[model samples]
Target: MAFTPPKETYTGKVYTLEIGVPPDTVRFGGENVLPLHGFEGIVPSRPVIAYEIQDIPPDDWPDTVKKPFKDVSDDPVSWAKFCRDALKARAIALRLIGTHPDRENRSPEDAAKTVRDILSAIDVPLIILGSNHTEKDASVLIAAAEAAKDKNCIIGKAQEANYKTVAAAAMANNHKLIAMSELDINLSKQLNILITQMGFDKERIITDPMCSALGYGIEYTYSVMERIRLAALLQNDATMQQPMLGDIGMYVWKAKETQARPEDVPPWGSLEERGIAWEAVTAIALIIAGAELLVMRHPKAIEAVEKVVDELI
Candidate 1:
């Protein structure tokens, strides 16, 4: 007799989310098994990775990551097109970092204009992100949501402080919302409940339990994400069934491993290879932890993660 592998099944499935308009949309989640555990149950879609761009130049990004977009980074539209056409990016995430009060202090109107311009320039799905300033994001995301109305973009990052207003904006404009919380499973579920309480359909929301780099508390982040996935599947918790987001680039690029110069940290190897590998490893870890959508920088890093996803699925 042949030996057989034991398999486990689940009672719940993640909500499948579609972003962008028809003919160009991208979908993820809707899996009844844990990540890459398709042998046990249905796993309908592969993870989606979106290249991260900013409305303003990435002046603060370390040289290693910034070198790729040097020529087109000066303008958001040009930068977005480069990602789509040159890098073959399936989706794009535009962070309005310049709109932050501490940065260029660009107004909601300016952010809206940037959204319109980028939308016109690329056909791929766009994820509009605020600078993570809770107070300012409420206003900025509202304007950005309206600007991308009917385009079926994903507008985000409604936190506890501004979920009501931001959720309302995304609902009214017909865009998906990203509900982010600190690295706690309860907080993650609570935020999802709060957003749905406002009448925003829970299926349209993406839960971001937040993200951390490889050496910087990543184990904690992974545990929180894995527990969330288990609740969604094993416990059949509706509130925890939404797909997860790993905002990889922003967190990984800032880590000391990615930014430290080889000369300064003699044992760390080449700066460029170190940064790319750091990002790829962080992204792969999060994918295995149950992230269905990712926002990443570094073309080489994205390529490496894509290869890994292919082999896993």
Candidate 2:
């Protein structure tokens, strides 16, 4: 017999989703093999990185990461346009951080208007996110989803505390949903089951099993993602088969390695280069662990990740 390579076969396939209006859309998921294992099965699309922007000025962001958007960060619409026109971002995630009760405490109407403006400005896919205050997100995200109605956006972060409201809004607006759960396989599965139980289609869901920074429990995150993927592909667990979301920039940029100054950490080298590497490493690791979609901040980090994806695919 001719020598043959043994490849693990998978029965389950990730749900394919399209975001943004037609003529300017991106597709993700729909793979039958392990990440980057194209020889074993089909990998229809490479993972996508969506540049992350915020509804208000990102004053909280550290100076290093904040420097790139210094000119446009004051206006969300202008920041989004810069990402689309200059940075060539494939997708844009507009996080309504201003709506947080502690932050600007912007009203739902403010969130809605911001969505409308960003949608009008950018043709790439939009990922609408709330300030992540569970209670506030229930209302804020509802307004944002309705604002982007019929645009095929991904309205997120329906956690255990607020899945019903967010899921209903996404369902009502005819958009995709993101179900987030703490980093546990069982919790992830349970949340997915709960969302689908509320009459939302499971095929339209994306699983965000809460990501972590490179040093802080990233291995735990890695293992959870790996298990989720194995459950989806090997065991054919329908509840765990939705595509994964890394949300890489939020976690990666916060780590000490990314924020520490060269004067403080002489061994780490340049702060800017260190931050970029921090994000790129985390993103690549997640992809290997089965993340099909990512939301990132730094342009340099995004460029590095895209280069790696190009080489792998």
Candidate 3:
């Protein structure tokens, strides 16, 4: 008699989404198995990684991550083009951090113009991100959605404070919306419900249950994401079935492990390699936990995760 491996069957599947105009679009999700467990069920798409850029120069970014794009970083268009043409990015996420009231306080129109310029410069999918200011994002993302209309972008980060307005913009412009909540599975599901209740199609939503670096409550983040995935796959919960996003770069790059100088922390070795490893490890953990889309910085970190994804699939 031949020995047989036990395979678990899941009833639910993640919604498949396509971003960017056709011929240049990327698709993800539509998997029914646990992450990387393709042998157990259908796994039509591997995870997608988007290189993170910004409307303004990445001045706040640490030297290690910022050095790579030093020449083009000053101009958003040039920065976006460099990522697409030189870095071979699959997708680009333009974070409108300059629009924050405390930052440059750029007007919505300024953000819209930046969106148009970057859209014109790059054919790959674009993910338009606000500066995580709940109030500012409501207005900024609305303008950005209009500017990128019909180009098929992903407009995000509709949190509890501003999901209605942001979700409306995404709905009006026909772009995907990323519904984010704190690191709680219940909150994530509740936010999704609220968005869909507004007549935004649930299938077009992506769940961002927030993100954390490796040593900074990453285990909690991982647990929430895994439970969400399990709820979707095992319990067949429709509210939890949307694909997840791990905004890896922002969180990973901020951690002390990524920012500390080797001289200051002699045991950590090179700062650059340490930063890259921090990002890669964080991203890989989320991917295993059920993140179908990742927004990451550091070419080497993205490269490392990409290689791992290839091997896993």
lDDT of all predictions, in order shown? 0.94, 0.92, 0.94
Poorest 10 consecutive residues by lDDT, candidate 2: 56-65
Off by over 4 Å in 3: none
lDDT of 1 by residue, 82-108 (tens): 999999988999999998999999999
For candidate 1, give the lDDT of residue 37. 92
Which ranges in model 2 have alpha carbons more than 4 Å from their true place? none
Q: What is the lDDT of candidate 1?
A: 0.94
The deviation in Å at residue 190 for candidate 1 is 0.8
Q: What would you estimate as the lDDT of candidate 2?
A: 0.92
Q: Model 2 over residues 1-313: C-alpha lDDT tens digits?
A: 8989888889988888888898989999999888888899899998989999998898878777899999999999999999999999889998898999999999999999999998887777999999889999999999999999999999999999999999999999999999999998899999999999999999999999999979988898889999998899899999989999999888887888988899998999999999988898999999999999999999998999999999997
Per-candidate TM-scores read 0.99, 0.98, 0.99
**Model 2: how far residue 80 lies from native, Å:** 0.5
